[model samples]
Target: MFEISDTQKIGVGLAGFGIFFLFLGMLLLFDKSLLALGNILFISGLACVIGLERTFRFFFQRHKVKASISFFGGIIIVLTGWPLVGMLFEMYGFVLLFSGFFPVAINFLRRVPVLGTFLNLPGISGVLDKLSGDSDRTRV
Candidate 1:
């Protein structure tokens, strides 16, 4: 009894292809730069593979601001791959992308020693709240 939805099948295929290209680019490609392009493909494909409900939870829940930035960063990375900026974007995007899903880490990260200082900096929380659509309070 193996019945899978069309979307799930598509997701599995995209994820598989992404992983294959990633390995191929890293292990077989003549040019090392194809690795970055492969990474971009991998991230975008993974994004597409994730379901809307989980994606929404990741992007709009505890780490909405971080998730949004990472998703957009992934786009920018893909666009700028040829220009060499995509590599940097991909690295940063991956970090935030994963962080967006692990709710426990969000608060933990905010409480780290040096990192906490930066996280607590003025105006950041307000902007984050606004991005998350939390309208409990008014800002002047």
Candidate 2:
């Protein structure tokens, strides 16, 4: 079985709170302070969960350099009181950074009962497929 350390557990909680704050910030029309807090919490949580060295390695990898710049730049922008633009930059960086995992995530989601059914719908499935970069594959 896999073991999660106490620090990682705390990290998970912090990351969850970060995500909640991020959502709330958006709900409140992109409040700068909440977004900044979320960014700080999320980054710290990630470092705690994975270790500072690993986090640094992950972000600074050659192929991920641009993504790292965009993601951190977005955080800086948010801290400077440009929440909307910062969020947009972050979104782009996030998508570029995580696109490779989309197919795996989509496939996993397709197995969850209610969500699976909803995802299998024509329009939804098509959009998911496109986003996952699986649109070129012929489904059996």
Candidate 3:
């Protein structure tokens, strides 16, 4: 049986093509005239190769060290005249910071008086679950 889910098929196909494009892009990078195409292919391939879930988890998961590294790395890159790479690093840094901070903020708020009650409210809790993207739907 060669049965495959649509999601799996898409993911696999994208990954395959992504690898090819990524290599092609890297190879083409040596030619200044074709650098633009290389950049497009590289970015597209990278996006396809990683897929959204992994990318989201990379940014959203708890990773203080990685985030700090990215933030500072971006700064260093910018200083070295690589604005584009620096921008990417900075973007990752901001996302990592947000992801890392939100949970801490939520925990701190939970200890507050009125805010804690509001956070525990049924409607508010639902929103929190949605924001946190927890599939289990269980409460603490």
Cα lDDT computed for each candidate against the true fold:
0.57, 0.90, 0.59
| Candidate 1, poorest ten consecutive residues by summed lDDT | 131-140
Cα error, residue 77 of model 1, in Å, equals: 3.3
Separately for all candidates shown, the number of backbone clashes (residues 3 or more apart, or on different chains) is 0, 0, 0
Estimated TM-score for each candidate: 0.44, 0.91, 0.31
lDDT of 2 by residue, 46-72 (tens): 988999999899889899999989998
- Provide the global lDDT of candidate 1 against the true structure: 0.57
Q: Which candidate is the best by TM-score?
A: 2
Report the C-alpha displacement of residue 132, candidate 1, in angstroms: 28
Candidate 1 per-residue C-alpha lDDT over 1-140 given as tens digits, one digit per residue, 9 for 90 to 100: 97767777676776677667656754663234555556555555555667766756666666457646765665465455542344445556556666444445545666689986775565875554444444363443
Q: How many times do residue backbones clash in model 1?
A: 0
| Better by lDDT, candidate 2 or 1 | 2
lDDT of 3: 0.59
TM-score of 2: 0.91
